[model samples]
Target: MICLYIGTNTGSCGLITAQKDPVPLKSVEVELEVRDHVATVVSTLNYENKEDKPLEAVFVLPLPGDAAVCHFSAQIGQTQIVAEVKEKQKAREEYDDALSSGQQVCLLTESDESPDIFSLCVGSLPPGESASIRLEYVTELAVQADDGLRFCLPAVLNPRYQPQGSAGAGFQVTSVPASLEPYSLSFSARVSSPRPVSKVESNCSLDPLQYLNTDQTQATVKLAAGHKFDRDVELLIYYKDAHQPTAVVEAGQASAEPGSLMGDPVVMVSLYPEFPQSVMSSTASCGEFVFLMDRSGSMGFRIKRRSLQTCIHSAKDTLLLLLKSLPMGCYFNIYSFGSRYEHIFPKSVEYSRQTMEEALKKVKKMKADLGETEILEPLKHIYSQPCILNQPRQLFVLTRGWVKNDKEVIDLVKKNSSSHRCFSFGTGENTSYIFINKISKEGGGHAQFITATDKIQPKVMQSLQFALQPSVIDISVTWDLPKEVSVTVLTPPITSILQGQRSLIYAQLTGQSSEAAEGCVTLKYSLAGHPSENQLHFSLRPAEDTGLTVHMLAARTLIRSLEMEARDNKGERDEEMKKVVEELSIQSGVSSAFTAFIAVSKSSGEAIQGPLIPPPSDFWHISAALLGQAQNYHDIHVCNFLITATESELSVKDPLLQLVSLLEASGCWLLKPALASVLGKTSKEVANLKPASASSEVWATILALIWLHGFKMDAKDEWELLAMKAASWLRAHNATCVTECVEAGNALLGCRVTKDALGL
Candidate 1:
C-alpha cells in the first residue's frame, strides 16, 4: 500500500508505503499547455523496476498557469489507485509573466486545495532521489498611449506552485529609448518564466512632440517596469518639420532670424549663481561714496570682544580701498550719527591717496556712545552741509532697524532725490524692509540687508556698482506684426546696453498674421547722452503652440531676483514681495518658499534650535510660519526661533557658527548701544526663567548670552563685565567653541578686535 501527505503552504511533500524491494524512479516530468485561454499540466514518473513490490513514489510538479490539473496513480501490491488534484499554476504564471513584461501583474494565492481538480497520489520507491523539475519563460513589453506614451513589461512565474503574495518575483521595464519617428518610442522585455497565455499588442504611439524642446532639437522619454521581468531596449526616431533648427546657437547667428526673435535672446552671462566679479569691480568705481554710520547706545553690543569696533574697522578698510580706486575729482565724507549727527572728517574730502588713509584712521578711532538711534538727523544734517549741497553723492547708511522717526528720514531722502542716493544696510534679522525700501526708492538707490557680517564687503561692493551705473536710460523696441496684433516687452531696467554683452528682452505677440509672416524689431537705448539700438525679427505661423521660449528664460531671471530679495528681507513681510514670490514659484515649478512652508508647517510649532545640531522637523515649521507672518513684531519672534534653532542644530565645533558670529558682529555695529543694553537685561531675565538640568533650554541661554555680550562697551562698565561672564560660560560649556566666537564677543564689547583676530 502507498500513502501520500503534503504540506502545501510549507512546500513539503512526501510519500509513504509498505514495500519489500521497490526500485526508485530516476526522473519526474510535468508539461503545461494552454489553448483558448484554458490550461492543463500533466505529471509523469518513470521507474526502472516494474515488479509488483508495493512501491511508494512521490513526484513534484511545476506550476505555470492560473488553473491546472494534477493526475496521479498509486501501485500497491498489483493494485492501482488514481486521483486528481486541482492547481492554480496557469493563472499565477500569467499574472507573474505580465508583470515582468512591464504590464500590470496581479496574483492571488490560496492555501487550501478544496476543489478536487488536482490529484494526490503516492507510490513506493526503493532507490536514489531524482532532481526537481522547474519551468521558465520570457516576458514581453506592453505599450499604451492616449495623451502620452507609456511602456510596460510583464513578469513570469511557474504555475504548479503558487508563490506567496510577498514573494520576490515580478517584472520590471528595463529601458525605453526615444523613437526616430516624430510620434513615440517602443518597449521590449525579457521574461524569467514561461507562461501558456501571453500576448503582445502592437501599433501603440506615444506623442513625441510633448517631450520635444521648444526649438525641437531634443526630446525626453521615460521607461517603467510592468510585472515580473526587466529588459533594456533602444529608441527609434522619426523627424518632422525639417525647417526647424537642429542645434542651439548664438542669438546673432542663424538662430537669431526674424522668427527666432519672438523669443528672448539666450545669453551666457553667468556661470555661477553669483553676479559677476568684473561687474562688481567696474560698477564700484562709477560714483563717489559718503559713509553714514550709527554710533548710538545700541551700537555698544560686543562682537569678538569689541562692540561695533570690528565693523568700524571693516568699513574703514572697504572705504580705504574704494577711495584709492575712485577716479580723479571723486569726493567722499565720513559721518557718524547717534541722537545727534557729526562728521568724523570734513563734510567732503576730495579723493586722494593720503586723505583716504587719514579718513580711515579717523573712522577706526571713533567710538559708540549712549544715545537713541536718530537715523534721519544725520541725513538732514548731511543735506544741509555746504560741501555736499550741490554735488551728487551716494549715501551708504549702516544701522540697526531701531531708528526713531524713520518716516522723517524717508521723506528727507525723497525730497533730495536729484542730488543723493541712499543705500541702507542693516545687520540683524530685525532690519526693517519698509524703511530700507522707502529710502532706497526715494534716493534712487537699492537697499542691502546683511545678516552675515563677513559678507558685508562683497554686498556693499555690489550695491555700489548698481548705484554707479547710469540711473536714467531708455529702451525702445519696434517689431513687425500683423494688423491689430498685440505685443508686450519685459526686461530689467537697463542703464545702458554694453557692447559685446547681450541685452535680454521679452515680448509676447498675438493676433493672426499671414501664415509664416516675418517682421523686424528694433531696440534703441539712450544712456548718459549716448544712444544705441539693435534689431531682431521673427517669422510667425498659426499653430496650436508657438516655439517661443524667451518668456521662460525671462521668468527665470525674475524669479532669481525675487528669491534673493526674499532671503535679504529675512524678517519682514511685504505684500508686493509675496505676490512676486508666488508668481515666480508658479512659473518655475520650483518654489523654495513653498518648500520652506511645508518644512515649517510639518513641525507643529516646535522651537527649532540649531548651530551645532539639527533640530527636529517641527522647529523648521514654526520658524517658517513665523517668518511668513505679516506683522514685524511677529516676525521678530521668527528670527528668535531661527537663532535658537541654529544653536540647537550646531555644535560649538561646527564651522557654520563662525558665520553666526560674524552676523552677531554686524548686529553690534547696526544696533544702538542703548537698545543693546535693554536687550541684555531682557535676555538675562529670560535665562533666569529657564529651569536647571534642561539641555533643551541651552539655545535660549546662548541667545541671552549673545544679547548681553552684544551691548558691552570696551570700557570697564557693567555690560563689559556681563559680556566677559557670557564668553566664559560659552567656552566652558561648548567644546566646539573657537577663537572666532571670542573675537566676535570682543567686537561686540567695543574692543579693537583686528581682522587678524577674526581670521578674515
Candidate 2:
C-alpha cells in the first residue's frame, strides 16, 4: 500500500516530516546560461516564517537526470553564507546539532530515494525572517534528429509505483494537476555557440529572439510571462554545422591546486560515429517485434493537442506506420497494460496481410480504460513467451512513459536483453524521460520522445529505422596521450552504439604535459561481423579562466558510476565504498547522496521555543487548492435583461461554436471516415475535396483550415478528438493556391494552421 501525507501547509513532505518547523517555502526562481553545448542553471528558492517561533523548512524537488550540482548557498538579509561539501552523515549530524543549539543553518542533500530527486532544509529560522537559497548546476544538452540541441527544466516528479516489499520506496509523490500548482516560474536563457545560431524553439511561447552579435553566434530569449508551468520548459536550439564531433578542455578553479579533480584540466569528447554505408546497407531487418502499450488512467489525460489529434492517436498512428513498414517476413504481437493486461495473439504471428490487418483493427479500437499504471505483469508475460527460431526479437514499448515501477521494469529489460532489443517511444509532454532512457540503454535499443511540439511521423520512423538496423557490439574507447599524462575514465563503458546516434566520454587529465601536446581518443565497435573505429584529436592547451563545468560534470559521471555499483551492493555501507564516495564528493564539491552542502549563519539573538509546528503536509494544501479553484474567481455572467442564451443563436461561422458542436457530437476527435459523416458527406466525396487551399471558397476548404486550429491551447471543453480530414481537404482543393486566404483568416482569427501543424 502507498501512503501520502496530504496537508495544506509546509509540513514534512519528506525529511524532517515531524519537526517543529514553522517556515513555509514561498517562491522559486531559475536562471539558465547556455554556452556551446552545456547549460549552467542557478535556482533560487525563498522561504518565509510567519509563525511566532523558530522553524525548520524542508522541500523536496527534482533535478534533471544529467545535472551536476556544483554550488549551494543561502542568504538571510545581507548575511550570505556559502556551503561546504562534507560527508552526508557528518553533514546531517552537524545540521541537527546546529538547529538544536539554536543556530540558524541551511542544508541541501540528494534523496536516498532516487538520484535525480533532492531535498533542501532551512533550519532554525527566527520568526518573521526570510531565507533565500540558491543552487547551481550544469548539464549537457541532448541533440535531436533535427540537429537541434534540447534542454528541459523540469516541472513535477511523476510518482512511481513500488511493489510490496520494495526497498527504500517510501514517499514517492503522485503527480498533481498542473493547474493546481501554486508556484510561478520565470526563466531566461543566454546562449553562445561557436557556430552561427539559426533559431530557438520551445513549446511555450518566447519573447522575440535577440542576437548579441552580427554573426548570430550568441543570443538570448526568455519565456514569455503568464505562460503555463504545468509542463516541462523545453528549449531546442538550432546551430550551423551541427552534428560534428568535437572536444573541449575547461580550465580549473583559481583557488584550487593545479592537479586535482576540481582544479585539474578536464576534457569532454563528443562522438557522432557513423556506421559504414556497407554495414548500414546490410542491416538485418527480420525480427519478432513485440509492442507493449500503456493503457493507464493518466494515459487518458492528454498532455498535448495538435490539429484535433491527441497523444494517444499520434502514438497509435506511429505504431500503425511501423507495422505497415515492417519487412514481409517477421513475427509481431502487442501487450497492453494498466491495472491488467491482455495480448492479441497467444504467441507472435507472422507479419503478413491478415495478421497486420488484424492488429491494426484492434489498435484502432484500443482505449486508455485500464485503471492504474501497472506494466510489470504484461512485461513478464511477454518475456515468458518463447522466441522464434532464426528471427531476432525486437520489443517496441509505446506508452505515456510515466509508470511507477520503472526501476523494476528497467532491471527486467536488462535481464532479458538477450531475448530482444527494446525500442521505447514516449508520447505526450512530460513523459518519464529517465524511465524510457534507462530501458533503451539497458535493452540495447533506441528511445524517442514525441511531444506536442514535435513532428511525430518522421522521428517515429527514424526509431523504426534504428530498430531494423543491426546493433553494434564490442564497443571500446581508447585514449592516446603523453607518457606521464594519465587518464581516469569517469563514465561507464559504452555498450549501445546505434547508427546516427551520439555518445560522449568524460575524463580527468593528470600529470604535466607540454602545451604543444595534443590527445587523441578513438572508439572501436563491431557492426554485424565488421569492425570500425572513429577518432578525434584535441589540443592539450587549457583555456583561460574556464569555470568548474568540466570537473563538476566529470565528478557527476563518476558519482553515478559509483552509485550504480553501490545500488547493486544491496545498500551495503562498507568502509571502502564510504571512503571513495566521500573523497570524491569532498574533492569535487559536487553534492551527492553520500554528501551534502551545509552552511551556518552567525546570529546574536535567543531562539524561541514555542508550540511545535509539526512539519506535516497540511501547510502545502491551501495554496494549491486555492489556485486550483481560482478558475472560477471571476466568472462572467450576462443578465437576463442584456441577453438570453439559445442554441439557435450559435452561428456556423463562429469557429469556437463549430468546433464545440463537431467535437461534442462525435464525442471525440473523429478520424477521416467519422469526419466525413460529421460534415454530411461520404468518405469518397471528402477525399475528393482535398484540393481546398487558403483562398479556396469550397466548404471543405474552410472546414479544413478551421480543423487545423481546433486544438487550441485553451480549447474550452477538456474533451479532445482526432481527425485526418484537413490533409485530404487541403490537397483536394489545392492548398498552395489557397494560402492567401488561409493566411488572412489566420491573421484575423489569431490562430495557426501550417503544413507541419496539419502533418501534411
| Highest TM-score model number | 2
**Residues 634-745 of candidate 1: C-alpha lDDT, one tens digit per residue:** 2121211121112122223322222223222111112223233434334444334334443422333243344433422222221222233334444445524334443444
Backbone clashes, candidate 2:
30
Model 1: ten consecutive residues of lowest lDDT? 596-605
Best by lDDT: 2
Relative to the true structure, candidate 2 has a C-alpha RMSD (angstroms) of 10.1
- Per-residue lDDT of 219 in model 1: 36
- Candidate 2 residue runs with Cα over 4 Å from true position: 1-26, 168-172, 175-183, 253-259, 305-311, 403-405, 570-575, 604-760
Weakest ten-residue segment in model 2 by summed lDDT: 633-642
Quote the positional error of residue 221 for candidate 1 in Å: 24
Task: Name the lDDT value of residue 612 in candidate 1.
Answer: 12
What lDDT would each prediction earn against the true structure? 0.36, 0.67
Clashes of 1: 138
lDDT of 2 by residue, 36-71 (tens): 788899989876667666766656566876688889
